[model samples]
Every structure is written in structure tokens, then in C-alpha cells.
Target: MIGLIGGMSWESSAEYYRILNQGIRERHGQTASARCLLWSFDFAEIEELQHRGDWVSLEALMIDAARRLEAGGAEVLLICTNTMHKMADAVQSAVGVPLLHIADATAEAVKTANITRVGLLGTAFTMEQDFYKGRLARHHGLDVIIPDAADRSTIHRIIYEELVAGQALPASRDAYRAIIARLVDDGAEAIILGCTEIMLLVRPEDSAVPLFDTTALHANAAISMALAD
Candidate 1:
């Protein structure tokens, strides 16, 4: 069974849940789906902790969640948010189940496409920090490109205000397309939908470059591991 630590935003986590089941059934034939244990948290509470810069308490909360999943018989663990993956190490250590890193999964997908440089779009924390990008550099030797300050601010704003809120504006989609065009012109071979919810807005057709949806890659990786020898 796979364990899911989700609800960083109910939207993203819900998509992960649907995709995981859909992919599993497709892979193993009719009625064959992943047996998953989902422990979804309150996004408001988690966001409050993040805004306060309380890493210790945040880690503790996630660790507790992972422990609960493991104790309840989940064999593998998944953190359903891109930004919250910063706490992955702590949670993995506290639980007996193997926790899959979303960045690793995305990196492998990028490498398979033979692309070394990609533009990334996500929350401000994910863009400014090394946790996700650093892991990609260290593990896959890929160069990640992010938007400029103004673009980052706009991207971050749209992600939280629009995407998380279950609203998709045509203007927001155009903004993302403009950013992707600039990134591709600046030599990015592809774009990484770094935030899970970002994929909810930006589709492959929106970019001249290929779009790598981390949520799909991560979910597919989990199903592969769950069924692997």
C-alpha cells in the first residue's frame, strides 16, 4: 500500500489521488488500483506555520503524519506537495516506509527526455530555496532556470490566489505562456511545472517547450515502485 501525506492544498492532493488510481488501473488492468492510505492536512494550518517560518514545528507535524500512515499499514510514503517536500527527510526518518522524493522522479523524467536545462514555475519558497532545485542539480546534474523577480512574484501570486482557490483565469494562463516563451528563448529546453497545482493551469499546449508535470511523474513513480520486484 502507498501512503499519501497531502492536502497542502486540497486541489493538488485531490489530483494526485485521482491520477494515482487512474494510472494504477491502467497499468495493472481493469479494477486494479493502488491501495493508498491518505492523510490529508489542513492547508490553512500548514500555511500559517510556513508563513511563520516555523520549520521545527512543521517537520514535527509531517513526521507525525508519516508515522500514522506507517502504523496504519502503508508500505510506502509520498508527500503530495512540491513545496512541502522540504520536510521529506524528517518525515522519512520518522516512518519505516520508503518515502519517494518528487524531485528525483521529475529529474529522471527530464533526463529521459535528454534535456539538461528547464524553466521552473512554482511557489516562492520552492523557487528561492535549494531544497528542490539543489536536489535536482546534485542527483541529475540538471540546470534549472526560474523567472525574474517580477515574473516570480506574478507566478507565485497566481498559484496561491487563483490555482489554489480553484480559479483559472485566461489572463493568468497568458502570463504563464509569456514567461515560458521567454524562458525557451533564453535556452531552456523545457519547463518544469514545479508546483503540483501549476499543472492545473499550464498544459503542454501552452508551451513551445515540453512541460514536465511533477505530480504525474511522482504519482507514476509511486505506482511503479508499489508494483516492482
Candidate 2:
């Protein structure tokens, strides 16, 4: 069984839930699905913690969630949001079950594709903080590229103001495509949709370089683990 810690904006969390269960149904026979445990948080409170730079408080909440899931018989834990993964290590340390790192899963996918340099687009914290990109580089030996200050701000704004609000405008899509084009010109072999909500605005069909949808990749990894004997 898998434990999902979600509700970071709820939109992308819904996608994670849907994709995980759908993968189960498709892989197994009809009416067959993996046993799962879920713990959702009030995203408003979590976001507040981020703005306040209160990681100590944030880590406490996550550790508590992990413990609850472990007690509920979850074999593994998955944090559905990319930004929240900044606390992943602490949560894993405090919990009994294994926590699947999203960046690790995406890096494995990138390795399979033989891509060494990739562009990333995610929330401001995910992009600016060393946690996500550093992990990809330190652990996976891949080069990570991000947009400049202005473009990074634009991408971050679109994620929160538009995508997380369940809005995907054509203008937002075009803006994202332009950003990806610049990254491709700068030698990006693939584009990592680092933000869980980013795949909603930009997709493989719209990009010249291959698009690594982190949400999809993470979901596949979880399903693979859950179904494996």
C-alpha cells in the first residue's frame, strides 16, 4: 500500500490521486486497485509557512503525517507536491516507511532517456532553492537549467495565479512554450516540468525537447512499487 501526502493546492493533488488509481486499474484486472492511505493538509496553512520561512514548523507537520500513514499500514509514502519535498528527508527520517523522492524518480527516467542536461520550471521556492536541483545534480549527476530572474518570476506566477487555480490560459501556454524554446536553444536536451502543476500548461506536444512530467513519472514509480511483489 502507498500513503499519499497531498492537498498542496489540491489541484495537482487531485491529479496524483487520479493517476495513481488509474494506473492501478489499467495494470490489474477490472475492480482491482492497490490499497492506499491518504493524508491531505490545508494548503493555505502550508503556504503560509513557506512565506514565513518556517521550515521547522513545516517539518513537524510532515513528520506527523508520515507517522499517521505508517500506522495505517502504508508500506511507502509519497509527497504529491514538488515544493513541499524540501522537507522530504526530515519526514523520511521520522517515519517508519520509505518515502519515494520525486526528484530521484524523475532522474531515473532522465537517465533512461540518456539526457544529461535538462531545464526545470517549478514554484519559485523549488526553482530558487538548492534542494530540488541540487539533489538532481548531486545524486543523479545531471545538469539542471532554470530560466533567468524575469522568466523564473513569470513561470512561478503562472503556476500559482493560473495553474493552481485550475486555470490554463492560451497566453500562459504560449509564454511557457517561449521559455522552453529558449532553454532548448541554451542546450537543454529535455524539459523537466518540475512543478506538479506545470504539465497542465506545457506538455510534450508543445515542446521541441522531450518533456519529463514529474507528476506522471512519480505516479508511475509509486504504482510500480505498489504492484511489485
Candidate 3:
């Protein structure tokens, strides 16, 4: 069973749920669905703590969620949001099951494409902090770039104010396209849709370079782990 620690925003978590079950049916049969457990959090509460930099409280919440899933018979775990993965190591340590790191899955996909440099799009925490980017650099040997300060602010605003609320506006899409173009000009061979909700605003067609959707890759990786012998 796969344990999904989700609902940093239910918008992207919905995508995770859909992809996991869809992948299962594709691999097995029409009626087949993934055997998974979801421990969803209220975004309002989680976002409040995140903005306040209350990581200790957030880590406690994540650890509790992971333990509940593990106790509920989950064999493997996935933290569905890229930003919330700040607590990934702690959550994994508190659980007996394996927590499939999204950054690891994403880095594998990026490396598989033979790309050495990538642009990242996510919340301010994900783009500015060392946790996600450091892992990509130190563990995967990939060079990660992010949008400039103004562009970063725009991206972050759209995510919290629109995307998470299930709005995919054309203006937001246009802004992302422009930001991606800048990253490509800066020599990004590919772009990482580091935020799970990012795939909602921008698609491959929006970028000149390749776009690696972490949500899709992470969910697909979860399916593989669940079906592994």
C-alpha cells in the first residue's frame, strides 16, 4: 500500500489521486485502482504555519501523519507537495515505511533526459531554500536555477492566490511562459515544475525547453513502487 501525505492543497493532491489510480488501471485492468492511503491536511492551517516559519510545528504534524499512515498498513509513503517536503526526512524517520522523495524521483527523470541544468518553479520556500535545491545538487549532481526575484514573487503569488484554489488563469500562464523563456535563455535545458500545482498553470507547450512535471513523475514512481515484486 502507498501512503500519500497530501493536501498541502487538495488541488494538486487531487491530481496525485487521479494519476495513481489511473496508472493502476492502465497497468492492470479497467476496474483496477491503486491500493493507497491518504492523510490530507487542511491547507489553511498548513499554509499558516509555513508562512510563519513554524517548521517545528509543521514537522510534528507531518510526523504524526506519516505514523498514522504507516500504522494503517501503508508499505511505502509519498509526500505529495514539493514545498512540504521540507519535513520529508523527519517524517520518514518517524515511519517504518519508505518515503519516496519527490526530488529524488524528479532528479532521476531530469538525469534520464540527459539534462544537466534545470529551472525550478515552486513556492518561495522551495525555490529559495536549500532543502530541495541542495538535495538536487548534493545528491543528484544537477544544477538547478530559479526565476529572478520579481518573477519568483509572481510565481509564488499565483500558486497561493490562484492555482491552489483551482484557478488556472491565462494571465498566470502567460507570466509562467515568460519566466520559463528567461530560464531557457539562461541555459536551462529543462524546467522542473517543482510545485505540484504548477502543472496546472504551465504545460510543456508553454516552455521552449523540456518541462518535467514532478507531480506526474512522483505519482508514477509511487505506482512502480506499489507494483514492484
Best by TM-score: 3
Question: Where's the lowest-lDDT run of ten residues in candidate 1?
Answer: 88-97
Model 3, 49-86: lDDT tens per residue? 99999999999999999999999999999999999899
The runs of at least 3 residues in candidate 1 whose Cα sits more than 4 Å from the true structure, single-residue gaps closed, are none
Q: After superposition, how far is residue 159 of candidate 2 from its true place, in Å?
A: 1.2
Q: Could you tell me every candidate's TM-score relative to the true structure?
A: 0.97, 0.97, 0.99
Candidate 1, 151: how far from true, in Å? 0.7
Best by lDDT: 3
lDDT tens per residue, model 1, 42-152: 888998888789989999999999999999999989999899999888887787779999999999999999999988889988988999888888879999989899999
- lDDT (CA) per prediction: 0.90, 0.91, 0.94
lDDT of 1: 0.90
Which portions of model 3 miss their true places by more than 4 Å? none
Question: Candidate 3: RMSD over Cα atoms?
Answer: 0.6
What alpha-carbon RMSD in Å does predicted model 1 have with respect to the real structure? 1.0
